[model samples]
Target: MSTLGGAGTPNPNKSFEVVQPPTDSISSLCFSPKGNYLVASSWDNQVRCWEVQKNGQNVGSVPKAVMSHDKPVLCSAWKDDGATVFSGGCDNIVKMWPLASGGQLVNVGAHDAPVKEVAWIPEINLLVSGSWDKTLRYWDLRQQTPVHTQQLPDRCYTLTVKHPLMVVGTADRNLIVFNLQNPQTEFKRISSPLKYQTRCVAAFPDQQGFLVGSIEGRVGVHHLDEAQSSKNFTFKCHREGNDIYSVNSLNFHPVHHTFVTAGSDGAFNFWDKDSKQRLKAMARCNQPIPCSAFNSDGSIYAYAACYDWHKGAENHNPQTAKNFIFLHLPQEAEVKGKPRLNTGRK
Candidate 1:
């Protein structure tokens, strides 16, 4: 298959275009709801907000504000109402920040282990989080304590919540979908062909189906309703290699049927869900990708942070640890006119 952008087209290899953050190893990246800013979490225990300008321009100036954390920041999410930003970290804490006032962060720690993932449901004013503590908790911004908690058999790596429904992927290669409306309800778990852990999960824009990427470099697409049945449809994505490290990150284009994934091998791939074809593969970073996020309009611009695996290496080394902002353009086709043939040849 041709590369993501087009066939025979030269790839636009852009540099990181770095914006100074407190740390180099960014654990997560999130585009704010308004698309005016980006929130990044670093292993250095800080969350920095960068202002994004219009016209696909480079980020303006340095980060506007830095939110301090007691431990390494793991993941972050922006509220739908655009009022607050939520962050999770290794200290087992989840924080909420007011975006209007220069990004002031308020600690809302309630988990027992490192919080791995968080999502906000603005319609209900609820924040849901998944943690390495083997549990999922629901928090209401207005309250100090968790409204409810669901214990899982394994550590949760990533989670996405859509109002009353929540989907969580675990380190044990299990995908659990829960009905948040009933806090006491048992989670519906779906098993995958690959026993490796799930690194990321993303739901379809229309909530029709969802995709899950595993550490084994394989992706499975499951129909929402069929996921609970004994028989389900699961497709393996990348087969180039299967080291089972981590899928790292996954994001769907807001307006397109395509989605992109990055992983341990630094392989960035785009897939067509309808055909399940590997659309494109780009240059590998030779490092582990920690996180990736797409811009608001679902344009080509996406950013990913790589972690330094070398021992005793500087965490912020520009060469070793770098954040990539890749620009993926839409595919184009050439029109060829049919040649005319002589009707009467003597």
Candidate 2:
């Protein structure tokens, strides 16, 4: 097996728990808003929640609970109340889970194609989903139909919410911003900071801008405010030797303006935006790090270490690839960047 610190060998210097789950590959992972639980979606068509409350917990050790979809699960999010979970998959449907009621799967929404991203807008208690169908649908849990649907220029792949505004990245390198409070005006479309297709997007803690990742191993710091947008910039990440790897996920620390990124390079790195410096770089897996999430309290970070094998079926290696979830208690020495006011969520 690959052993990086290059192969990611188990060592004492390490500060994280490595978990092996009996699954294929992980597509997405998110932390519970209320507790130490983590919800993950996998290419195995399953969604599982693992508790990371420092009780010797790891991936396969009884995930608190597991749920399945008809096709590979792609994206997931938790409501602000932390009682309900939202999940979307290749089946083109988004399902709502009532965690307080024994994990009942309730079909809440659907799309014309595979749903690429979903997020909870707390101000309105709305669930918004974007699909390859080139549309964004807004849904209210009390109703079965969407409250409104907006068309996009191309397939929507990445999405982020920031209360007053939201951003959606679509095919053709398009980044569209919608004013949450003033929907009557035309949506604002901006040139994507990256040239490749968007892989992930996260709203900045300050709401002055956001982070956007691409399949081309690059990330762009974008500012929504006119004067600040000109100051935006991009950087490269997830490259090993000469291979270009996809940046699968990006998340900003709840309190720290700094952020973390996971990539197909089989690693994740922490960064400080203001200083433009890397806080930490971890080479801890043999497969891609598809997703990573921070807990509500920001005391812990959970990540999925697995082979997305997203290149194609021909590139998959079942014997060599193992599925896992890792939880790390980041020390101040490892990730404490300059602290800033914590924004609620995206």
Candidate 3:
């Protein structure tokens, strides 16, 4: 395939621009709901927002702002409207930044330990955060007190939310699913199908179930209805020479139900959830990808290639640790294929 930006054949060699912020490794990257901006948070204790060219102009590194946190900001999320942002970090604090009111963080809530993830649900006007403290806390932007809190069996590792359904994956290999209508109650609980630590979870676009990734390069496709879950299966990726990489991140395409995955092996891949077939895999990257996301409109896909401290010391280099954000204009074929045949699902 030609490497230039054309149709579904995007030129991989030419990036919109390269970013080298965050003296330490980048932890996450998320595009604004507007699709014209992206924000990244890092271990360096700063969150940088970059301007993205939606019109396909010759782009360069255009950073809009730098916000500070006391410790590594593990996650950054944009609200449904795209003007406000939420961040949580190792300092156990969750903050809200209003772009229109002058980019100042309002201390919203805190966890007992490092905050691992933050997810915003516009439907309920609610924000949910998970932590190593082994609990999930719900917050209302209009109030300082948490709306509700639910304790988990172990440290909360990953959270996946799709409208009325929310799923939490924790350190105890517990998979907890909840109905968002009643935030504090648990809907179902099951042991993780994977043998290793939970690395990531992404809800299916239709909310049928979710995809789970682990440190052992394994991914499990699950369905809420066990009858439909007969097709629930596990696959492996991120395996390089003599090493198995953690499946670091997963995002489902909005228009197409297919999903994209990134891993510690410094790789990104596209897959069809129904047919259980991989559509494409990018060239191996120079650093592990910690997180990835797609804009609400699905025109752009973004990912952060940075060092992961949790990987221990085997394959990381402090000298080479970077804050590399990648942008790709995914063609229809690369992200989606023809409608997968049902082959007669009962």
lDDT of each residue in 1-346, candidate 2, tens digit only:
5332145543222445545463777877888778777888888888887766564432223457788899998889999887788999899999998886786799998898999888998888789999999998889998889998888899998888887778888888888888778643435788787998888888777667789999999999988778876568899999867988999888887766578998887778899877677889876466677888888866688777766766788867667666767777766655677554456755
Q: Compare candidates 1 and 2 on lDDT and give the better one.
A: 2
For residues 252-315, what per-residue lDDT tens digits would candidate 1 score against the true structure?
Answer: 7666647777776655677666654556666565455557777776653445535533223533
Give a tens-digit lDDT track for model 3, residues 1-346: 2111112312243445445566777888888876577888888788788777666645455777878889989988889888888999999999988864566789989999999899999999989999999989999888888988899999999998998889999996899999898877899999999998998999887888999999999899999997897889999888866778899999999888789988876778988977778998887665667888887777778876666766465655557444567776777887885576876967
Model 2 RMSD, rounded to 1 decimal: 4.7
**TM-score, candidate number 2:** 0.89
2 or 3, greater by TM-score: 3
TM-score against native, each model? 0.81, 0.89, 0.91
Clashes of each: 0, 5, 3
Tell me the whole-model lDDT of each prediction, alpha carbons only. 0.67, 0.79, 0.81
The runs of at least 3 residues in candidate 2 whose Cα sits more than 4 Å from the true structure, single-residue gaps closed, are 1-22, 55-62, 183-186, 338-346
TM-score ranking from best to worst? 3, 2, 1
**Candidate 1 whole-model C-alpha lDDT, 0 to 1:** 0.67
Q: Candidate 1 vs candidate 2: which has greater TM-score?
A: 2
> Number of the top candidate by lDDT?
3
Return the top candidate by TM-score: 3
